[model samples]
Target: MSLIPLARLLPRRRSLGRSAAALAIAAVFTALFTAPAQAADGRISGLGGKCVDVAGASNANGTPVQLYDCNGSNAQRWSLPGDGTVRALGKCLDIVDRGTADGSLVQLWDCAGTPNQQWVVSGANDIVNPQANKCLDVRDRSTANGTRLQIWTCSGQSNQKWSAPGSGGGDPQPGGFVVSESQFNQMFPGRNSFYTYSGLTAALSAYPGFANTGSDTVKKQEAAAFLANVSHETGGLVHVVEQNTANYPHYCDWSQPYGCPAGQAAYYGRGPIQLSWNFNYKAAGDALGIDLLGNPWQVEQNAAIAWKTGLWYWNTQNGPGTMTPHNAMVNQAGFGQTIRSINGSLECDGKNPAQVQSRVTKYQQFTQILGVAPGGNLYC
Candidate 1:
């Protein structure tokens, strides 16, 4: 996720080139390589310690597949039937639209035993789609959550390497109050399986401090508060990208050298936290080793990447706010400070009490549901 300009509501031009240098490089590395032990049931781990996950964990045809955290879920399980096809959820992992070009999307389709659906593990760890003679690549060599899987020429990059089942190191145990699939669904019933448990787990694994900081009670409160804010931002995860198309063109900042590779109108607010702006996308992408500046739509297209962008903001950025949201929660500065960290200038100090209260109301409800008390300072 990229940064949201605090000046987004104001007339002034806001720069999204905030320094992400302070963010831990180790966290980004861990996110890309953390994985569980190979299970008796075939499960492959790839870049960012993520399992190749079926979108929404659905067995339905045309379901998309992306990299997510290894959660020992059936959705992460796969099987090579030795017929040259990778099988999951009773379907074949296929190249979408029968596209042979670089960066074509991958999806689950009915097992027609076609050549396009067949994959081979080359000696260099490339998951080669024999039809196009291209390797299954983590789009843009990204370790960022929700980065789509595409087929590119074999590059021998870490993003293209795959550790087959029963190989590699042991799985890292998930610590703290991990959010369950049922609870996530309960919070956003309309979301169904779109916001997947494995995706959230993967993001959390990458940035453990987001929910694992401080005491268990504090951890739960932080998790609840973060989700509450995210829910409010996304309207319960119903919308993937910002609804207004008019504001899309305003995100590009031509002053930067790499200036909006995707498009002038790209980099609109997207994903759970609504990451927006060109510079923010570039910084976040650089830190996570993903090329979001070149492909900003990956946020809305991939759920894991979407959640990761949100968490990236919550944990690393202070923006126009005084403190990072992670600090506010861990230090017991109260939820009001968090609101300030996120959009204080616009919503805090009686600027927009209604919006502040809306966030607070969600936090309170989430705390109640998580069985933790919402600490004081609910107002900005």
Candidate 2:
């Protein structure tokens, strides 16, 4: 069971039994994750080597954390078990009493796993509070004992640097794309079970650049923007097809060279973004290699195909706007541009503020859950 010997046995695994090889791999993982994490039982020292200490050695819920001399006191003993919290005296290092602002003071509070309690030790040695997008800073840059700590704009100043417990381990972030499956459900709780998480993830392969072409914040912002617009399109993914049956037959335009072979009423709005027009079905079908024009019903039938049709329009078509929704997000055009790209002419420029607000509200809520700020220009 000793890792040292098991690790040595890994390189010679071709000669070992299958059970031995599995054990060696297990040993590797155990060593990687079970090692004593940094700051597991250490004092987090900042400017002037002072420990990040809890005031008065209190275990109460609202105790203020302060800069104090490194006495190895119980108050200075801290543990960061790599779940985004700096723990001491059985409470979490928290942003207390005020909103997540630049000057919010730090405290010890109940470990609720909220964004206010999340901290990440970056490569620059600064402890960042993600909700406010600020760093754990020394108030007034003071090294004096009892100087309360606060979250401030990170300038990479010496006072902002700290030797904390872990660097790469923190609260769970977006693993693949910015929208995790849990977050997707929260964003669309009324979504049809057909719009499975597996379907969305599988569709990501169709558009290689979507939600994957920007910084972490930008990635999250783009995801929020996309999901918000689609939420409007599908009524929170609750509808697999357009409701009004009267407009169903009108989506087929006879002017196209290849007319609606699936009949006039076949190409109704369907899927996440709803491929409605016959020409649109043809285009999406060609791009996705799925004969959607000939068989428009496929969008509502296959979950992954449904998501792919949605991604097709989002990444390629501009609808009534100048840019695709994908380009709007990755190119720094803001969420407003995405709205324009999705349905701007009808909803943009004060024509339908209520509808625009609906999308913006969802985008804001999704971004909040993703632990990122929603960027500006949210309205079309």
Candidate 3:
């Protein structure tokens, strides 16, 4: 029951015979998955890598992965000998059977886990086959392109050192595990690329108290949910388009000196949440150390700054001792604020205010799903 068309949105399924073969392979994978290994995160050393279901990272079958200190974590659990060839979560990773050259896409498939899905881990952090002689390599070292896995020399670079890093509780670091620019767009059709820079990831890693809520389970769920909602609102990670800006410019005056700049301001919306208008742009710049008025495009250029603006808005609207602005549809309520911000901004015009019932409806919807008040922790 997806919004996009099935034929366009999903990959096709395999035939019956292929399905049986895949299951047989699954039996073998399951046996391996349960066996004790030198590096026990349920991972086998010197052969296959682990699988984590994070976005813009691992693909279905032929997805390239790396090795790390194994802990039998779900992110690391892999099933190689299964009905489908390369799989995780009971789905397969597919390599274009007759793919050409080094950058061909490695996609997911239904496992009949065949030779294509079967990879031999050679040396440290290298997926290779003594038979094939080629090792797993990412094409052009371009994290921007989707998962185009191919056979290259066994150099064992970071690009080749992939792991199925699982998502568990607490807030994921600002720039945690992300899909490469290429893979992000491929996985999500009609979407801009989602790339997480190393700096933000490192920063988030350091600020566990603020980034993660201290619970791995809740953190993972919240991270996934947050990414999904924000991606929908921001038009992927690029903020390339502003679908909700017709009414919700959040400006005091469109014609005022401090309104939107003639060429910019409301022209294209700035920052991650795309703060628009002269007032908000100036405010965001002041708060986040960027002069949005002087140079509006910086919002897209510096991802960390873009995120800072979104966080600033969120904190200002909900942080302690702060008053919620009339322009901001969502504020001071936990998840409710996120929902209201998303829902209300979708319909608000700078001239007119956000509809209360619309925001309330979204809040109710989120509450029902999350089982708590929206923005609950932030408000109190």
Output the number of the lDDT-best candidate: 2
TM-score of 3: 0.36
Comparison by TM-score, 2 against 3, better one? 2
- Location of the lowest summed lDDT over 10 successive residues in candidate 2: 1-10
Give a tens-digit lDDT track for model 3, residues 1-380: 11111011111111211234533553565465332224334343332333333223444444444333344555445554422233455555445573423444455566664555544432133343222223456566544423345655333344444432222222233234332322323433433322223212322322233324534434432333344434444544444334444433333245555555545324355544555555556666765555676666655654444545555554344222223221222222343334344433333233223333333443344333434433343211
Task: Give residue 171's error in model 3 in angstroms.
Answer: 14
User: What clash pairs does model 1 have?
Assistant: 1-309, 32-48, 32-49, 33-48, 33-49, 34-49, 36-171, 37-171, 145-305, 146-305
- The C-alpha stretches of model 3 lying farther than 4 A from their native spots are 1-190, 194-210, 236-239, 243-267, 318-334, 341-380
Residue 134 CA displacement from its true place in model 2, Å: 44
Superposition-based RMSD of candidate 1 using all C-alpha atoms, in angstroms: 14.6
User: Which stretch of 10 consecutive residues in model 1 shows the poorest summed lDDT?
Assistant: 10-19
Q: Residue-wise lDDT of candidate 1 within 1-380, one digit each (tens)?
A: 44455323322112222123322442465465644344445777787677788878898988878887777788878887666778888998899988867788898899997867877653234466645545677887666666778776544346766766521211111342345445665676554234544445544533657777778789888888898887777677666667777888988888888888899999788877778888888887776656788989877765556667887788888876778889999999988888888778788889888888889998998888777889888888
Return the TM-score for candidate 1, rounded to 2 decimals: 0.59
- Pick by TM-score: which candidate is best? 1
For each candidate, how many residue pairs have backbone atoms clashing (under 3 Å)? 10, 2, 58
The candidates, ranked best first by lDDT, are 2, 1, 3
